[model samples]
Target: MTKRSTPSSPQSRGNAPRKSGGGWPIPTPGDVLCYAYLWAREAAQGQEEGLKDRPVVVVLAATDTGNGVRLTVAPITHSAPDGAEGAVEVPLAVKRDLGLDRERSWIVVSEVNGFLWPGPDVRPLADGSPFYGAIPDWLFLRMREGIGVHAGRGRVRVTKRTE
Candidate 1:
Protein backbone atom coordinates (compact mmCIF):
# COMPACT_ATOMS: atom_id res chain seq x y z
CA MET A 1 0.00 0.00 0.00
CA THR A 2 2.67 2.52 -0.95
CA LYS A 3 0.92 5.86 -1.12
CA ARG A 4 1.87 8.73 -3.35
CA SER A 5 1.36 12.40 -2.69
CA THR A 6 -1.34 14.26 -4.55
CA PRO A 7 -2.91 17.70 -4.47
CA SER A 8 -6.28 16.34 -3.44
CA SER A 9 -5.10 13.35 -1.41
CA PRO A 10 -7.50 10.68 -0.37
CA GLN A 11 -8.72 10.75 3.20
CA SER A 12 -8.81 6.97 3.34
CA ARG A 13 -5.42 6.32 1.70
CA GLY A 14 -3.76 9.41 3.15
CA ASN A 15 -2.08 10.09 -0.21
CA ALA A 16 -4.43 10.01 -3.14
CA PRO A 17 -6.30 12.30 -5.50
CA ARG A 18 -5.14 15.04 -7.77
CA LYS A 19 -8.43 16.71 -8.52
CA SER A 20 -6.82 19.88 -9.73
CA GLY A 21 -4.65 17.96 -12.19
CA GLY A 22 -7.78 16.06 -13.11
CA GLY A 23 -8.10 12.93 -15.21
CA TRP A 24 -8.97 10.05 -12.99
CA PRO A 25 -10.34 10.79 -9.54
CA ILE A 26 -7.82 9.49 -7.05
CA PRO A 27 -9.00 6.18 -5.67
CA THR A 28 -9.47 5.73 -1.92
CA PRO A 29 -10.86 3.01 0.23
CA GLY A 30 -14.61 3.36 0.90
CA ASP A 31 -15.07 5.71 -2.02
CA VAL A 32 -17.97 4.46 -4.04
CA LEU A 33 -17.36 4.73 -7.76
CA CYS A 34 -19.70 3.83 -10.55
CA TYR A 35 -17.96 1.24 -12.71
CA ALA A 36 -18.67 -1.54 -15.12
CA TYR A 37 -17.62 -4.40 -12.86
CA LEU A 38 -16.72 -7.58 -14.69
CA TRP A 39 -17.55 -10.58 -12.55
CA ALA A 40 -15.31 -13.65 -12.45
CA ARG A 41 -17.98 -15.78 -14.00
CA GLU A 42 -18.34 -13.35 -16.83
CA ALA A 43 -14.62 -13.21 -17.40
CA ALA A 44 -14.40 -16.94 -17.43
CA GLN A 45 -17.15 -16.97 -19.99
CA GLY A 46 -14.91 -14.75 -22.16
CA GLN A 47 -16.84 -11.59 -21.45
CA GLU A 48 -14.90 -8.37 -21.02
CA GLU A 49 -17.21 -5.51 -20.21
CA GLY A 50 -19.37 -5.65 -17.13
CA LEU A 51 -22.97 -6.57 -17.66
CA LYS A 52 -24.05 -3.29 -16.14
CA ASP A 53 -22.53 -0.31 -14.43
CA ARG A 54 -22.90 -0.37 -10.65
CA PRO A 55 -21.63 1.28 -7.55
CA VAL A 56 -18.47 -0.32 -6.22
CA VAL A 57 -16.59 0.36 -3.01
CA VAL A 58 -12.86 0.97 -3.11
CA VAL A 59 -11.81 -1.63 -0.60
CA LEU A 60 -8.10 -1.42 -1.34
CA ALA A 61 -6.05 1.08 -3.33
CA ALA A 62 -2.31 1.38 -3.84
CA THR A 63 -0.37 3.79 -5.95
CA ASP A 64 1.30 2.27 -8.94
CA THR A 65 4.34 3.67 -10.67
CA GLY A 66 3.84 6.78 -12.81
CA ASN A 67 0.53 8.09 -11.46
CA GLY A 68 -1.39 4.90 -12.08
CA VAL A 69 -3.26 3.34 -9.17
CA ARG A 70 -4.21 -0.25 -8.64
CA LEU A 71 -7.50 -0.99 -6.97
CA THR A 72 -9.52 -3.78 -5.47
CA VAL A 73 -13.18 -2.89 -5.33
CA ALA A 74 -16.24 -4.67 -4.02
CA PRO A 75 -19.60 -4.41 -5.67
CA ILE A 76 -22.62 -2.83 -4.03
CA THR A 77 -25.93 -4.34 -4.95
CA HIS A 78 -29.56 -4.39 -3.94
CA SER A 79 -29.66 -8.17 -3.98
CA ALA A 80 -30.13 -9.69 -0.56
CA PRO A 81 -27.03 -11.64 0.37
CA ASP A 82 -27.05 -15.17 1.73
CA GLY A 83 -24.27 -14.44 4.25
CA ALA A 84 -21.66 -16.50 2.39
CA GLU A 85 -20.61 -13.54 0.27
CA GLY A 86 -19.44 -11.46 3.23
CA ALA A 87 -22.01 -8.84 2.38
CA VAL A 88 -22.57 -5.91 4.73
CA GLU A 89 -25.67 -3.80 4.64
CA VAL A 90 -25.24 -0.07 4.05
CA PRO A 91 -26.79 1.81 6.92
CA LEU A 92 -29.78 3.77 5.70
CA ALA A 93 -28.39 6.93 7.20
CA VAL A 94 -25.13 6.49 5.31
CA LYS A 95 -27.00 5.87 2.09
CA ARG A 96 -29.04 9.02 2.55
CA ASP A 97 -25.93 11.06 3.13
CA LEU A 98 -24.41 9.75 -0.10
CA GLY A 99 -27.60 10.55 -1.99
CA LEU A 100 -28.15 6.93 -2.91
CA ASP A 101 -31.62 5.60 -3.42
CA ARG A 102 -33.83 4.26 -0.62
CA GLU A 103 -33.50 0.73 -1.97
CA ARG A 104 -31.44 -1.39 0.39
CA SER A 105 -27.96 -2.30 -0.83
CA TRP A 106 -25.11 -4.40 0.46
CA ILE A 107 -21.39 -4.18 -0.12
CA VAL A 108 -20.37 -7.53 -1.49
CA VAL A 109 -16.96 -8.06 0.04
CA SER A 110 -16.60 -11.70 -0.87
CA GLU A 111 -16.16 -10.77 -4.51
CA VAL A 112 -13.97 -8.04 -5.92
CA ASN A 113 -12.33 -6.78 -9.07
CA GLY A 114 -8.83 -5.50 -9.72
CA PHE A 115 -7.98 -2.78 -12.19
CA LEU A 116 -5.93 0.31 -12.87
CA TRP A 117 -7.30 3.73 -12.12
CA PRO A 118 -9.07 5.54 -14.95
CA GLY A 119 -9.60 2.23 -16.64
CA PRO A 120 -12.10 2.17 -19.46
CA ASP A 121 -14.83 0.79 -17.24
CA VAL A 122 -14.54 3.47 -14.60
CA ARG A 123 -17.00 6.31 -15.00
CA PRO A 124 -17.38 9.53 -13.07
CA LEU A 125 -20.51 11.22 -11.87
CA ALA A 126 -22.30 13.74 -14.08
CA ASP A 127 -20.58 16.48 -12.08
CA GLY A 128 -17.15 14.95 -12.92
CA SER A 129 -16.34 13.85 -9.36
CA PRO A 130 -14.40 10.63 -8.92
CA PHE A 131 -16.90 9.08 -6.54
CA TYR A 132 -20.34 9.57 -5.11
CA GLY A 133 -18.86 9.80 -1.61
CA ALA A 134 -17.26 7.57 0.95
CA ILE A 135 -18.83 5.16 3.35
CA PRO A 136 -18.28 5.75 7.08
CA ASP A 137 -15.13 4.45 8.80
CA TRP A 138 -17.03 1.97 10.95
CA LEU A 139 -18.74 0.53 7.90
CA PHE A 140 -15.44 0.35 6.02
CA LEU A 141 -13.87 -1.60 8.85
CA ARG A 142 -16.76 -4.04 8.78
CA MET A 143 -16.23 -4.51 5.06
CA ARG A 144 -12.54 -4.99 5.67
CA GLU A 145 -13.30 -7.67 8.21
CA GLY A 146 -15.49 -9.43 5.72
CA ILE A 147 -12.71 -9.26 3.14
CA GLY A 148 -10.25 -10.70 5.63
CA VAL A 149 -12.64 -13.46 6.61
CA HIS A 150 -13.35 -14.41 3.05
CA ALA A 151 -9.72 -14.17 2.05
CA GLY A 152 -8.72 -16.38 4.96
CA ARG A 153 -11.25 -18.97 3.84
CA GLY A 154 -10.04 -18.62 0.23
CA ARG A 155 -13.46 -17.55 -0.93
CA VAL A 156 -12.73 -14.05 -2.15
CA ARG A 157 -12.91 -14.08 -5.92
CA VAL A 158 -10.77 -11.43 -7.52
CA THR A 159 -11.46 -10.82 -11.18
CA LYS A 160 -8.74 -8.86 -12.86
CA ARG A 161 -9.74 -6.21 -15.39
CA THR A 162 -7.29 -6.03 -18.24
CA GLU A 163 -6.91 -3.72 -21.20
Candidate 2:
Protein backbone atom coordinates (compact mmCIF):
# COMPACT_ATOMS: atom_id res chain seq x y z
CA MET A 1 0.00 0.00 0.00
CA THR A 2 1.17 3.58 -0.64
CA LYS A 3 0.38 4.69 2.90
CA ARG A 4 -1.57 7.48 1.28
CA SER A 5 -5.37 7.63 1.05
CA THR A 6 -5.74 4.21 -0.58
CA PRO A 7 -5.51 0.84 1.14
CA SER A 8 -2.90 -0.64 -1.26
CA SER A 9 -1.25 -0.76 -4.78
CA PRO A 10 -1.70 -3.14 -7.80
CA GLN A 11 0.21 -3.73 -11.29
CA SER A 12 -1.59 -5.75 -11.20
CA ARG A 13 1.15 -8.87 -11.85
CA GLY A 14 2.55 -6.79 -14.48
CA ASN A 15 -2.86 -5.02 -13.85
CA ALA A 16 -5.12 -7.12 -11.68
CA PRO A 17 -8.79 -6.12 -9.72
CA ARG A 18 -12.06 -7.90 -9.26
CA LYS A 19 -13.72 -5.03 -7.41
CA SER A 20 -12.91 -2.46 -4.77
CA GLY A 21 -13.51 -3.70 -1.30
CA GLY A 22 -12.81 -2.35 2.18
CA GLY A 23 -13.38 1.34 1.53
CA TRP A 24 -11.32 1.40 -1.66
CA PRO A 25 -10.44 4.94 -2.62
CA ILE A 26 -11.83 6.71 -5.63
CA PRO A 27 -9.31 7.64 -8.35
CA THR A 28 -8.58 11.29 -9.07
CA PRO A 29 -7.00 13.13 -11.94
CA GLY A 30 -3.19 12.93 -11.83
CA ASP A 31 -3.26 9.62 -10.00
CA VAL A 32 -0.72 7.08 -11.21
CA LEU A 33 -2.09 3.61 -10.70
CA CYS A 34 -1.05 0.17 -11.85
CA TYR A 35 -3.75 -1.04 -14.21
CA ALA A 36 -4.49 -3.52 -16.98
CA TYR A 37 -4.56 -0.98 -19.82
CA LEU A 38 -5.98 -2.55 -22.97
CA TRP A 39 -4.28 -0.67 -25.79
CA ALA A 40 -6.20 0.36 -28.90
CA ARG A 41 -4.30 -2.16 -30.95
CA GLU A 42 -5.22 -4.94 -28.60
CA ALA A 43 -8.87 -3.98 -28.73
CA ALA A 44 -8.69 -3.90 -32.50
CA GLN A 45 -7.31 -7.41 -32.37
CA GLY A 46 -10.19 -8.45 -30.12
CA GLN A 47 -8.12 -8.80 -26.96
CA GLU A 48 -10.15 -7.63 -23.99
CA GLU A 49 -7.47 -7.03 -21.36
CA GLY A 50 -4.09 -5.44 -21.36
CA LEU A 51 -1.19 -7.76 -22.03
CA LYS A 52 0.37 -6.76 -18.71
CA ASP A 53 -0.24 -4.50 -15.81
CA ARG A 54 1.57 -1.16 -15.71
CA PRO A 55 1.49 2.32 -14.25
CA VAL A 56 -1.20 4.58 -15.71
CA VAL A 57 -2.04 8.23 -15.13
CA VAL A 58 -5.63 9.31 -14.63
CA VAL A 59 -6.39 12.01 -17.17
CA LEU A 60 -10.11 12.34 -16.75
CA ALA A 61 -12.77 11.39 -14.24
CA ALA A 62 -16.49 11.94 -14.57
CA THR A 63 -19.59 10.67 -12.89
CA ASP A 64 -21.17 8.07 -15.09
CA THR A 65 -24.87 7.70 -15.67
CA GLY A 66 -24.92 4.87 -13.16
CA ASN A 67 -23.45 7.22 -10.54
CA GLY A 68 -20.11 5.41 -10.61
CA VAL A 69 -16.98 7.35 -11.41
CA ARG A 70 -15.68 6.58 -14.86
CA LEU A 71 -11.99 7.20 -15.46
CA THR A 72 -9.93 7.73 -18.57
CA VAL A 73 -6.28 6.84 -18.11
CA ALA A 74 -3.04 6.85 -20.06
CA PRO A 75 -0.09 4.50 -19.78
CA ILE A 76 3.37 5.27 -18.47
CA THR A 77 6.08 3.36 -20.23
CA HIS A 78 9.85 3.29 -20.59
CA SER A 79 9.61 3.55 -24.36
CA ALA A 80 10.56 6.90 -25.79
CA PRO A 81 8.49 8.74 -28.36
CA ASP A 82 9.67 7.68 -31.79
CA GLY A 83 7.24 9.42 -34.11
CA ALA A 84 3.80 10.96 -34.05
CA GLU A 85 2.94 9.45 -30.70
CA GLY A 86 1.97 12.15 -28.26
CA ALA A 87 4.00 11.82 -25.09
CA VAL A 88 5.51 13.75 -22.23
CA GLU A 89 8.62 12.64 -20.43
CA VAL A 90 8.41 11.85 -16.75
CA PRO A 91 10.88 13.99 -14.90
CA LEU A 92 13.34 12.10 -12.74
CA ALA A 93 12.24 14.00 -9.69
CA VAL A 94 8.61 13.05 -10.24
CA LYS A 95 9.48 9.39 -10.78
CA ARG A 96 11.62 9.41 -7.66
CA ASP A 97 8.80 11.00 -5.72
CA LEU A 98 6.44 8.22 -6.86
CA GLY A 99 8.94 5.42 -6.03
CA LEU A 100 8.98 4.15 -9.61
CA ASP A 101 11.84 2.40 -11.41
CA ARG A 102 14.86 4.45 -12.42
CA GLU A 103 14.41 3.80 -16.08
CA ARG A 104 13.26 6.75 -18.22
CA SER A 105 9.51 6.80 -18.72
CA TRP A 106 6.87 8.72 -20.61
CA ILE A 107 3.15 9.25 -20.25
CA VAL A 108 1.69 8.24 -23.60
CA VAL A 109 -1.22 10.56 -24.25
CA SER A 110 -2.24 9.14 -27.59
CA GLU A 111 -3.64 5.97 -26.10
CA VAL A 112 -6.02 5.46 -23.21
CA ASN A 113 -8.59 3.20 -21.58
CA GLY A 114 -11.87 3.90 -19.84
CA PHE A 115 -13.26 1.97 -16.92
CA LEU A 116 -15.43 2.38 -13.90
CA TRP A 117 -13.72 3.26 -10.66
CA PRO A 118 -12.01 0.37 -8.91
CA GLY A 119 -13.00 -1.99 -11.69
CA PRO A 120 -11.79 -5.54 -12.15
CA ASP A 121 -8.52 -4.40 -13.72
CA VAL A 122 -7.19 -2.61 -10.67
CA ARG A 123 -4.50 -4.55 -8.78
CA PRO A 124 -2.40 -4.12 -5.70
CA LEU A 125 1.35 -4.14 -5.72
CA ALA A 126 2.91 -7.36 -4.55
CA ASP A 127 3.32 -5.64 -1.19
CA GLY A 128 -0.41 -4.75 -1.23
CA SER A 129 0.04 -0.99 -1.70
CA PRO A 130 -2.55 0.59 -4.06
CA PHE A 131 -0.72 3.22 -6.10
CA TYR A 132 2.56 4.96 -6.89
CA GLY A 133 0.86 8.18 -5.81
CA ALA A 134 -0.37 11.19 -7.78
CA ILE A 135 1.50 13.25 -10.32
CA PRO A 136 1.99 17.00 -10.02
CA ASP A 137 -0.80 19.30 -11.19
CA TRP A 138 1.29 20.92 -13.87
CA LEU A 139 2.23 17.54 -15.31
CA PHE A 140 -1.34 16.33 -15.30
CA LEU A 141 -2.55 19.48 -17.00
CA ARG A 142 -0.01 18.96 -19.75
CA MET A 143 -1.12 15.38 -20.17
CA ARG A 144 -4.75 16.38 -20.29
CA GLU A 145 -3.95 18.87 -23.01
CA GLY A 146 -2.17 16.23 -25.02
CA ILE A 147 -5.06 13.88 -24.59
CA GLY A 148 -7.51 16.50 -25.70
CA VAL A 149 -5.50 17.29 -28.79
CA HIS A 150 -5.01 13.65 -29.73
CA ALA A 151 -8.61 12.86 -29.06
CA GLY A 152 -9.73 15.76 -31.19
CA ARG A 153 -7.44 14.62 -33.98
CA GLY A 154 -8.83 11.12 -33.69
CA ARG A 155 -5.40 9.86 -32.73
CA VAL A 156 -6.47 8.75 -29.29
CA ARG A 157 -7.95 5.31 -28.87
CA VAL A 158 -10.02 4.53 -25.79
CA THR A 159 -10.67 0.87 -25.00
CA LYS A 160 -13.49 0.50 -22.54
CA ARG A 161 -13.10 -2.43 -20.19
CA THR A 162 -15.75 -5.13 -20.54
CA GLU A 163 -15.56 -6.10 -16.90
Candidate 3:
Protein backbone atom coordinates (compact mmCIF):
# COMPACT_ATOMS: atom_id res chain seq x y z
CA MET A 1 0.00 0.00 0.00
CA THR A 2 1.10 3.56 -0.66
CA LYS A 3 1.83 5.82 2.31
CA ARG A 4 0.08 9.16 2.80
CA SER A 5 1.85 12.40 3.73
CA THR A 6 0.92 14.43 6.81
CA PRO A 7 -0.80 17.80 6.43
CA SER A 8 1.07 21.03 7.12
CA SER A 9 0.58 22.94 10.39
CA PRO A 10 -0.74 26.47 10.66
CA GLN A 11 2.75 27.81 11.13
CA SER A 12 4.02 25.72 8.29
CA ARG A 13 1.09 26.90 6.23
CA GLY A 14 2.09 30.52 6.98
CA ASN A 15 -1.23 31.22 8.73
CA ALA A 16 -0.64 30.42 12.41
CA PRO A 17 0.32 33.77 13.93
CA ARG A 18 -1.65 36.11 11.69
CA LYS A 19 -0.03 39.49 11.94
CA SER A 20 -1.15 42.87 10.48
CA GLY A 21 2.02 42.94 8.37
CA GLY A 22 3.47 45.37 10.93
CA GLY A 23 6.78 44.13 9.53
CA TRP A 24 6.99 40.39 9.18
CA PRO A 25 3.58 40.08 7.45
CA ILE A 26 1.18 42.00 5.25
CA PRO A 27 -2.19 43.61 5.85
CA THR A 28 -5.07 41.17 6.23
CA PRO A 29 -8.40 41.09 4.39
CA GLY A 30 -10.07 42.76 7.38
CA ASP A 31 -7.51 45.56 7.28
CA VAL A 32 -8.10 46.22 3.55
CA LEU A 33 -11.87 46.24 4.00
CA CYS A 34 -11.70 48.71 6.88
CA TYR A 35 -9.27 50.96 5.03
CA ALA A 36 -11.42 51.00 1.88
CA TYR A 37 -14.53 51.82 3.89
CA LEU A 38 -12.89 54.73 5.67
CA TRP A 39 -11.51 56.13 2.44
CA ALA A 40 -14.94 56.11 0.76
CA ARG A 41 -16.60 57.77 3.74
CA GLU A 42 -14.09 60.61 3.85
CA ALA A 43 -14.41 61.36 0.15
CA ALA A 44 -18.17 61.73 0.48
CA GLN A 45 -17.80 64.37 3.19
CA GLY A 46 -15.12 66.56 1.51
CA GLN A 47 -17.38 67.84 -1.20
CA GLU A 48 -19.95 70.54 -0.43
CA GLU A 49 -21.95 69.39 -3.44
CA GLY A 50 -22.83 65.87 -4.52
CA LEU A 51 -20.44 63.49 -6.32
CA LYS A 52 -20.26 64.08 -10.06
CA ASP A 53 -17.90 62.63 -12.65
CA ARG A 54 -16.08 60.88 -9.83
CA PRO A 55 -15.43 57.15 -9.82
CA VAL A 56 -16.21 55.36 -6.56
CA VAL A 57 -15.74 51.87 -5.26
CA VAL A 58 -18.84 50.03 -4.07
CA VAL A 59 -18.43 48.04 -0.85
CA LEU A 60 -20.66 45.03 -0.26
CA ALA A 61 -20.75 43.62 3.27
CA ALA A 62 -20.58 39.86 3.47
CA THR A 63 -23.18 39.66 6.23
CA ASP A 64 -26.88 40.35 5.71
CA THR A 65 -27.96 41.03 9.29
CA GLY A 66 -25.59 43.94 9.83
CA ASN A 67 -25.11 47.19 7.90
CA GLY A 68 -25.06 45.22 4.68
CA VAL A 69 -23.21 46.16 1.45
CA ARG A 70 -21.94 49.69 0.81
CA LEU A 71 -20.79 51.70 -2.21
CA THR A 72 -17.40 53.32 -1.72
CA VAL A 73 -16.61 56.90 -2.67
CA ALA A 74 -14.63 57.56 -5.87
CA PRO A 75 -10.92 56.82 -6.54
CA ILE A 76 -11.00 53.84 -4.10
CA THR A 77 -7.62 54.95 -2.70
CA HIS A 78 -8.22 58.21 -0.81
CA SER A 79 -7.97 57.78 2.96
CA ALA A 80 -10.36 59.52 5.31
CA PRO A 81 -8.71 62.36 7.18
CA ASP A 82 -8.64 62.21 10.95
CA GLY A 83 -11.30 64.28 12.83
CA ALA A 84 -13.44 64.36 9.69
CA GLU A 85 -16.93 62.99 10.07
CA GLY A 86 -17.15 59.41 8.89
CA ALA A 87 -18.86 58.78 5.54
CA VAL A 88 -22.35 60.21 5.76
CA GLU A 89 -24.82 57.35 5.98
CA VAL A 90 -26.68 57.08 2.67
CA PRO A 91 -29.84 59.17 2.61
CA LEU A 92 -33.24 57.38 2.70
CA ALA A 93 -34.66 58.78 -0.54
CA VAL A 94 -31.64 57.59 -2.46
CA LYS A 95 -32.15 54.06 -1.14
CA ARG A 96 -35.73 54.02 -2.37
CA ASP A 97 -34.72 55.07 -5.88
CA LEU A 98 -32.03 52.42 -5.96
CA GLY A 99 -34.67 49.86 -4.95
CA LEU A 100 -32.87 48.78 -1.80
CA ASP A 101 -35.57 47.65 0.64
CA ARG A 102 -33.64 45.02 2.59
CA GLU A 103 -30.40 45.07 4.55
CA ARG A 104 -28.81 42.23 2.56
CA SER A 105 -28.01 43.60 -0.88
CA TRP A 106 -25.08 44.68 -3.06
CA ILE A 107 -24.17 48.35 -3.62
CA VAL A 108 -23.05 49.75 -6.98
CA VAL A 109 -22.28 52.89 -9.05
CA SER A 110 -21.53 52.87 -12.76
CA GLU A 111 -20.57 55.14 -15.68
CA VAL A 112 -21.78 53.19 -18.69
CA ASN A 113 -24.12 56.05 -19.51
CA GLY A 114 -21.13 58.43 -19.36
CA PHE A 115 -22.31 61.02 -16.83
CA LEU A 116 -23.16 61.46 -13.16
CA TRP A 117 -26.30 63.25 -12.03
CA PRO A 118 -26.22 66.74 -10.55
CA GLY A 119 -27.56 65.42 -7.18
CA PRO A 120 -30.36 63.35 -5.82
CA ASP A 121 -32.12 63.03 -2.46
CA VAL A 122 -30.13 61.38 0.36
CA ARG A 123 -30.94 59.67 3.66
CA PRO A 124 -29.01 58.01 6.46
CA LEU A 125 -28.59 54.26 6.63
CA ALA A 126 -29.83 54.25 10.20
CA ASP A 127 -30.45 56.66 13.05
CA GLY A 128 -27.24 58.23 14.35
CA SER A 129 -25.21 56.40 11.70
CA PRO A 130 -22.34 58.35 10.13
CA PHE A 131 -22.33 56.45 6.85
CA TYR A 132 -23.73 58.48 3.91
CA GLY A 133 -26.32 56.90 1.66
CA ALA A 134 -26.40 56.69 -2.15
CA ILE A 135 -26.88 59.94 -4.08
CA PRO A 136 -26.69 59.57 -7.89
CA ASP A 137 -25.61 63.00 -9.05
CA TRP A 138 -24.61 62.42 -12.67
CA LEU A 139 -27.15 61.86 -15.41
CA PHE A 140 -25.00 59.18 -17.02
CA LEU A 141 -24.30 57.71 -13.62
CA ARG A 142 -28.02 57.43 -13.07
CA MET A 143 -28.52 55.53 -16.30
CA ARG A 144 -25.64 53.17 -15.49
CA GLU A 145 -27.13 52.09 -12.17
CA GLY A 146 -28.67 48.99 -13.72
CA ILE A 147 -26.63 48.84 -16.90
CA GLY A 148 -24.30 45.88 -17.32
CA VAL A 149 -20.60 46.49 -17.10
CA HIS A 150 -17.52 45.02 -15.41
CA ALA A 151 -17.01 46.93 -12.16
CA GLY A 152 -13.50 48.27 -11.60
CA ARG A 153 -12.97 47.08 -8.01
CA GLY A 154 -14.56 47.25 -4.56
CA ARG A 155 -17.80 48.31 -6.35
CA VAL A 156 -20.94 46.25 -6.68
CA ARG A 157 -22.79 45.75 -10.02
CA VAL A 158 -26.54 45.18 -9.94
CA THR A 159 -28.56 44.65 -13.09
CA LYS A 160 -32.05 46.08 -13.53
CA ARG A 161 -34.59 44.00 -15.37
CA THR A 162 -36.25 45.50 -18.41
CA GLU A 163 -39.85 44.63 -19.06
lDDT of each: 0.78, 0.78, 0.26
Model 3 TM-score?
0.19
Tens digits of per-residue lDDT, candidate 2, 45-119, equal 998888888999988788799758888889998988876457999899888888898899999998889988888
List residue ranges in candidate 2 displaced over 4 A. Answer: 1-22
Off by over 4 Å in 1: 1-22, 65-67
**What's model 3's lDDT at 39?**
25
Reference-based lDDT, residue 86, model 3: 18
| Candidate 3 wrong stretches, greater than 4 Å | 1-13, 16-20, 27-32, 39-44, 47-103, 107-163
Residue 93's lDDT in candidate 1: 82
The residue-by-residue lDDT of candidate 1 on 1-163, one tens digit each, is: 3222322223433444353234545666877888999988898999989998888889888876865678899998899998655699998887786668999999988889998887888876676655767777778888999999999999999998885
Report the CA-based lDDT of candidate 3 relative to the real structure: 0.26
Error of 3 at 89 (Å): 19
**Residue 75 displacement (Å), model 1:** 0.5
Angstrom error of the Cα, residue 17, model 3: value is 12
Flag the better candidate by TM-score, 1 or 3: 1
